[model samples]
Target: MIVLKNPHLSVHIDEMQGAELRGIYTPDARNALASYEWSSPTPVGRGASYGSSEMDWLSGYRGGWQETIPNAGQNCVVDGVELGFHGDASRTRWSIVDQGADWCTLETSTRLPIRVRRTMRLDPDRAVMYIEGHVVNESDLEIVFLWGHHPAFPSVDGGRIDLPDGCTIHPDVNRSGDLLTQDSPWPMAKTSSGEFADLSEQPALGSHRLLYVTGNKVGWSAVRQPDPYVSVAMSWDVAKHPYVWLWTMRQTPEYPWYGRASMFALEAQSAWPYDGLAGAKQRGQGIKIKPRGEESSWMTLAIIPNGSGTVTGVTKNGEVTFKSSEMH
Candidate 1:
């Protein structure tokens, strides 16, 4: 485990395992990132079957944050290269290129023809962590892929999700008994139960949903927990990541959860659908990179202790401000 600390926040990362972010800490929350009962901290050997990538990815999923690249979901073979579930970027080991008191740089190459490099930096006087990185295609031909950030936070009862204006929700899998299977404006959606449900409010356990929040004029999201009164705000470049994947696993009865998990992951992605690169390309949602081409993006995670239930905005530098009406 590689650790970086400042006066206001602490950051942890596992360099050997996809450079996975283990957790982020502030004075009010021990670890603000979501966790799981079955997730392992150490690497697990891969299974023989190609479809085993999901299990392989989950075997060591500590669930703080992960960098999904070259492929975002599922397993497929493109150009004779097998892309595992969530891709190789988060499953392969990364080398530490540099480190300091409150920052570290890591680099790794994937089974595909791309290379990734990222730097994690903690602010000196704020509860914020800035992640800046880029992915490069080193092969002699163009490559199509999906890239995104998977940051899961612990589920809180009565939690709320905040987004900017002009955003919409596109449901892919709806088990929440709420939300139409079609696109709905930002927060409110009509449910089959003959009532309106606030998509912004986190649902209770035993309900799960896989959806995409698109039409983002700006890239940012804030999850506010009422009881602990903590707000986690994430910000990024919308041009680089136009869609946000909202995954709510509230004690889901799926393979990994088995009715024993409760967490939410707001993934900022460059593509649509949970399908792998092949499927993404088929739908014309995959990103293309020419030989020796590189693309860069940055993200910021900010924590507000004892915050109001709303966040008006979050900047790339981690500056956070809450709703004025809710302020004391």
Candidate 2:
């Protein structure tokens, strides 16, 4: 575990696990992101075989933050190479290229002819973490791939998800059978029967939903948890990440949850349709990297203690300002 700390916040990165962010802690030692201790053994890569990626991914998931690269969801074959569940980066060990008191850079070479690099820098005077990263295609052939961030936050009963003004929401699966089959504008979704359901408001326990939100005027999202009076916010480049994948689950009775977890993930993505790289190719979506080309972006995360109110925007420096001073 590589730890980076400033006066106000601390970050944990697991070097053996894709350099995955294990946690972000406030002054009170509370982690803004979700972390869990599952009953099963830790998950590890078992080579790229059919149905193995999903099993390994869920078995080893510990709920911090992961970078799903080359592929986002499910296991699929790309260019005759099997890309694991979230790609090889999430499970591959990363070599630390450089480090400082408040920042570190790690690099890894994946199964495909690509190299991934990520740098995490903690603000010295604020509760903000800055992440800058890029993927380089080493092969002579161009590569079309899906790149995204997966950060999970604990879900409170009355929590709310805040996005920019002009966004729309579409669910991957309507297991709840309430959300509309089509896209609806932010904070409001039409049910199959034509009634309105509040997409911003977190649902009750035993409920789970995976939604894809797009058409955002800007690239930012904040999840406010009222009970703890803390808000976890993320801001990124809209061009690099055009979509936000919202995954919410409360004590889901399934293989991974088993009625023991409640959390939501706000992911910044470069492509659409969670069917992995193959799906993205079928839909003509995702980033296309030229031979030996590189793609990079930056992300900012802030932990606000009294930021449960409506957040107007989050700056690149990690400052959170509400709509009014009263909300503070």
Candidate 3:
């Protein structure tokens, strides 16, 4: 692991392939990050990489993506279908392309025969971190995958998500929503108070991060703790990505923290309702790239103190704002 420090903050990142962010700590603040669980690097049955099934790549044939694509040596498919989950380009190692006091860039090539470059910039003045992902389809064939950000935060009470206007929160239906019998209808109704009803009453925890999907073309989301010392805001280019995914889980005996304690990941995705491919066909909202063409998406996460934080989604100079007070 490599620790990069500045006057206002310090970030820990793995030196290995992914260059993953291990932790982000602010020494001037009282709320420090706690370590949490992640997938192990060990390869397992059917060529699954990582210790847990959730992180492993599953393919219809043996040896995974390595066998399907030329010069590919890792699993990158699920049940023989090409999909980007368990983190896009997560299976491959990333190389540091650039770094400075406040910014760093990493690049990697994937088994989909795609190339992705990520830039992480830390603004000490604003206490925010910006991540921009630029992806290129290097193959002649059309490539389709689900691309989304997964940033885990420390789960804690008093933390809630805020959405933009003309938007509603509904059950995932494919996953947790099955736990409910009614099967929530899409585009839920918002109360007169301008807040959507809480579909799940479970309180926030240091270990669990609530996940939600949004249909709004412009909006932002945030995860705030009552301690007043810790909070994070995420905004995206709404014109490019109209959806968001929130992921949070508690640490258990079965999982160990790779860095900070329990964390929450409030991910901004490219499409709502479904992953990229499904959204493209069903919603007709997907972006298309020419053979070997490139397209990029950007998301920003800002850390602010107390209830004064704000998250805004900006696209083509237009903005959709979400503030701390709007969180339920």
Candidate 4:
């Protein structure tokens, strides 16, 4: 394990194997990070040599392999066809294609029918991490999948989320088909300051985070601490993904992940209220590409050192624009 540390942040990367980020954040950020129990390492854990343990998880036949998709969900299946959760890209091992003081690239491919190249770059000076997902359809038939970025942020007491605009947020009906209510939209409105209206109840701040959905365009979300000592800002292109999932599971006694630590994940998702593939088929929002052609999407996450930073996105032609902010 290669550990990279600086005054502002610390990261662990594994070489030899596909270079992946094992740990991220500064020393002071440890308490929040360690509070939560991680199902697996940041990078997919793979062995140096191919063996039963390795093949059991990586291979499609074995049931022991935990799917690498984040934000608590399983594979998407429709009409007896299975679309692996969050796709198979994250679960597969990635190779270090390139690197630098502030940036690195990792590449991986799919087993069944698709080939994908995902690149992640981090710049401490700018306090930003850039992720690019590139997918190519190798088979003749069209392959349907869900593409999303799930970054779990550390949770703190009295921590609240900040959004760019006072946009309305709605949650999916729970298993019992009940809506979760909130007293107020934090950082925008006060919890005790107002009566319970249409918004869901303020999730008791815990190790579990929250999810919010935005419209297509640009938007930003921030997790603010009460002490003002630390804050994490996430921004992404709203054009490709308008919905964000805010997950918080601290109080639940049935699961071990409950309250281990809190993280406000700013997810960049291609669909809203449902998985990409399912949402597409249900709402006819599927993206179409020409044969042998390609589609690309990018998201930028900036962890402001002191309650400030910027997030932006650019096109293939280099046309760049701001996505969202809390940068004062």
Candidate 5:
């Protein structure tokens, strides 16, 4: 376990399991991250081999935050090249390149001629974490890949979700009941049962709702908790990562879920579903990387304190505003 610290927050990362963020804590809370209550023992050391995969990665799945490169969904084969879920980047061990009192940088390179470098920094007085990273294409050929961040946080029933202007729901990203292929504006959508289900709030028990957001001119998503009164607000570059996938899994009784765990994930990705590079190419959203090409973006997340309210907007300095309350 590698730990990065500051005055108000401490971020714990697990190097043994794909360098996932095991926990993100504040002074008031030990673990602000969402976790699964598995009856099974937590797996130690490295995970399964990429070749022996067909949706078995969740056998040892520990919910947290991880980076996905070139892929972000089920394992598949494209153009004779095999790709695994969320790709090998999250599964591979990352080495610490630099460290200091308030910040640390970790680096990893994948087999796809792409190298990723992520730097995490903390504010000394604020409850926030700043992330900066980039991908470099080492080969002469352009690489089409899905780059994103997956953070699973503790979501409560009735919590609210806020998105940017003109944001629309993506039907392909797994919806509950009969809302699978329906296209509707975010926050509120009519269910197949002729009832209006608020897509913005966390559903009741026994729900596995997945909502993806696209067509937004800006980049930001905030999950507001009504009980604890603290909300997590994330902001990034919409031009680079234009899509946001919001997933809530609760009481799923299938193989991996096993009717356990209650968590929500907010993903900021360059593209959609993890069908490998070919899938992005087919959607006409493939990024063309020239030889020695490099692309970069930054993200900021804050654990705002002391209020249960809706997030109206984020400032240029990364401070989230709760419309019902003041920033103090």
Candidate 6:
């Protein structure tokens, strides 16, 4: 386990277990964030790699946040080999290459010829986490990559989702209870049976819904709950990561889900359709890196305490703006 602190918060990363974020909680802030918890449950033991099977994949899950590369969905072929859920990034360990008083960096490489480096920064004055990352494609051939940041938030009965205008939804054809699969406007969609679903609100599905969203010129999402009023917001570079995925499940009866899981994962991704790189490439939305080339991006997340207001938007500098009104 690796820990980084900034007087107000303590961020823990499981360096040996897929380098996933174990948790982020306030230590001395004594504010609304003090009660914040990890979205993902702790792992049963050291996680096993996704061995082209759901059991192997989920056995390794210790999720708070994870990085997915080359692929971001279920088992599929990437560069001729079957890549399971979220690819090797979340299945491999990362090395702690650097650390200091308020920041730490992690680096990992994949057999797929990609190297990912992540650095997280915190400060004494704010309840936020900043992550900057760079990816290098060291292979000789240009390759399409489906990369994303998988930050799962615990489900709440009154969970409300917020996004910018012009956004539309694309339901994952592979998942069940796809209420809205077409290109509808943001936050509202009609099921195939013609029932309307408020995308902004998370409900009891009895099943699951996986989808990708477009029109993220304003790249951000917030999951707000009631009672304690603690809110979590995630913001990323829309230009680099143009797509966002909504992996909201309730009582999913599948093997990995086991009919006893509930979580809302608003994934900020760089590719599409969840059909692996081949599907993303066929649709021309898949991103590719030139031989020996690299790309960089950053994401910022905020923990809003007291949670009395709605986060209207977040600036590039990580300033969160909100109003007194709640969406739900």
Question: Largest TM-score belongs to which candidate?
Answer: 2
Ranking by TM-score: 2, 1, 5, 6, 3, 4
Q: Tens digits of per-residue lDDT for model 5 on 119-238?
A: 888878888888888789998877777778889877676677778767778655445544556678886766667877777877777777766787877788887776564567888877
Residue 233, model 5: lDDT of: 83
- Top candidate when judged by lDDT against the true structure: 2
CA lDDT scores, all candidates in order = 0.81, 0.82, 0.51, 0.47, 0.74, 0.74
Predicted candidate 2 versus true structure: per-residue lDDT over 33-130, tens digit per residue? 88897755444453342346787788788788999887887789988999988877888889999999899999998877888899999888778899
Candidate 2's C-alpha runs over 4 A off are 41-51, 173-177, 192-195, 325-328
Higher-lDDT candidate of 2 and 3? 2
lDDT of model number 6: 0.74
Residues forming the 10-long window of minimal summed lDDT in candidate 1: 41-50
Segments in model 5 whose C-alpha atoms lie over 4 Å from true places: 37-54, 173-175, 178-180, 273-276, 306-308, 324-328
Q: For each candidate, what TM-score against the reference?
A: 0.92, 0.93, 0.69, 0.67, 0.90, 0.87
True lDDT of residue 164, candidate 1? 88
- TM match of model 6 to true structure: 0.87
Query: Candidate 4 on 1-328: residue-level lDDT in tens?
Result: 5544455566555443333344566556642222232543222244342333223222321111111222113445554655455555545556767766555665666543555565656655654556676667666765554556655544445555555554555454442012343323422322233433222223554323343555435545655554544555666656555666655454443333333433444556665554436556577554444455566667655454443333243333222333355445
lDDT per residue (tens digit) for residues 1-328 in model 1:
8999988888889887888888787765578788654533233564343247887677667567999987887778888889898989887889999999899999999888888999999888788889998889998998777889999987778788899878887787524345567678888776767677787888767777878888998889998876554568999988878899888878777666676668889999988777788888888887788889998889999887555658878899888878788888
lDDT of 6 by residue, 1-328 (tens): 8887876677877788667776777664322221223333333344544444455766555347888876777657766777767777787778989998778899998757889899999856887889898989988988677778888766667878888777888777666375755767877777877888888888675747887898788888877777544577778988778999888777677755665667778889988767766677778876678999998888988776544466778765668777756633
TM-score (C-alpha) between model 5 and the true structure: 0.90
Which of the predicted structures, 5 or 6, would earn the higher TM-score when compared with the native?
5
